[model samples]
Target: MGVFTYENEVASVIPLTKFFKAFIIDADNLYPKIVPNQPQTEIVEGDGGPGTIKKITFNHGGQVKIIMHRLDIVDEASLTYKYTVLEGDLISDTIDQIVKEIKVTAGPDGGSILKNTSIYHIKGDNQLDKEKLKTDEEKGLTLFKIAAGYLLTNPDEYN
Candidate 1:
């Protein structure tokens, strides 16, 4: 029942609406380009829009492998993405279930608020250490910032 949240954020020179419209809404394509090592993230069983399903296959910790399906997408006003880890890696069997959710909103000073919450299951006498989780998440999210930085600076190049 313990919950962990991780946030990856950057101040876009562009408007918050534009950042939310592009990055969060069209994440499947953008995320892969932004962070390639984590997931292949191809549209497999469905289209690119809402209700589409994609298979995400990637390596974890060199010894662990993972495959997951992204389920639904809600983009009425803000974006709320739901997914399940169909297959998991070696880090934690506690990951009986896993999901990453992002809640984007217009922030003060014309910035965007990118809030992420990850739900995962862990089992056995041993549990995930906080530092490990934070380090791993920070690395992955840092990549997102890197890509976003490039896009914000050279808007048309990656658009």
Candidate 2:
């Protein structure tokens, strides 16, 4: 297994309360709209609460679609959400197993930090390439930061 971590910090013009709600509550619903470049994410089954599950269809830049089912979700607090990928095209098609989590926390002064962690279990039954995974994860983090920064500016009308 290999682990990758990525992070970004943003200064929010919006208040913390509104920022948190937009990020934790509204973002999931508006993700597909806000990130039109990505695949469609549908909540096949979920409680809208901790331990809830859902199915996410990830569309790649090449229009390749991968359906991923949620394994677990833990609402640690007001703005932190942790989840794992149970099943998906990326898992069955490419990798054997994967675990991804995102943590949102209030920054020291007045902003927030969105950190991403991705753990991968390669399928080849051989040693994993940590550097390659880290590079890919870094690229993902860059995109995430851009998306998140956009959300901070425009929480509504994500659709």
Candidate 3:
């Protein structure tokens, strides 16, 4: 198997604690509320914690496609979360799985800094598409920023 990894950092105006609570603790309930134009999400199994599984279905002109993610870690004190994409249309034929880790820390201006790491495990000698990976990272950063905006505007929503 081959492993490919990348890191991305996103800075937000929202506070670190609030960002962590909104994105990590309350994502299952907050995502659809904040991102109505994106895919619809549901917790198909477990209760939104370590070992919990979530299914996200995209509405593509009534043709629905799905992706499954399993939460692997949730650490409140450290403001960290980790999950793995067990099944998804985005996974290539040679890709086994994708593991993602996110850490939220206090920024210089009382906001938050998000650190994201993605590891792609591929089977055999297959090579990952770097452009696609970059695109995915960009998309994730956008989503995080949107969530941060939502939390900043509605301070009491997540808490």
The best candidate by lDDT is 3
RMSD of each: 3.7, 4.0, 2.3
The digit string of per-residue lDDT tens for model 1 on 12-105 reads 4555556665666655566656554755666667666655666666643444345545565666466565555555462355555567776666
lDDT of 2 by residue, 39-90 (tens): 5656667666655666766655543356454645545465555666667555
Give, for candidate 3, the lowest lDDT window spanning 10 residues: 58-67
| lDDT for predicted candidate 3 compared with the true structure | 0.84
Residue ranges of candidate 2 with Cα displaced over 4 Å: 1-19, 76-78, 92-94, 122-124, 155-159
Of the two candidates 2 and 3, the one with more favorable lDDT, higher being better, is: 3
TM-score of 2: 0.68
Q: Number of the top candidate by TM-score? A: 3
Model 3 clashing residue pairs (backbone) = none
Q: Tell how far residue 79 is off in model 1, in angstroms.
A: 3.0
Going through the candidates in the order shown, the clash numbers are 4, 1, 0
Per-residue alpha-carbon lDDT of model 3 for 14-108, expressed as tens digits?
Answer: 88988898888877677777676567778889977789898998764432277798999999999999999999775768889999999998998
Off by over 4 Å in 1: 1-13, 32-39, 48-51, 58-66, 124-126, 157-159
Ten-residue region with minimum lDDT total, candidate 1:
59-68
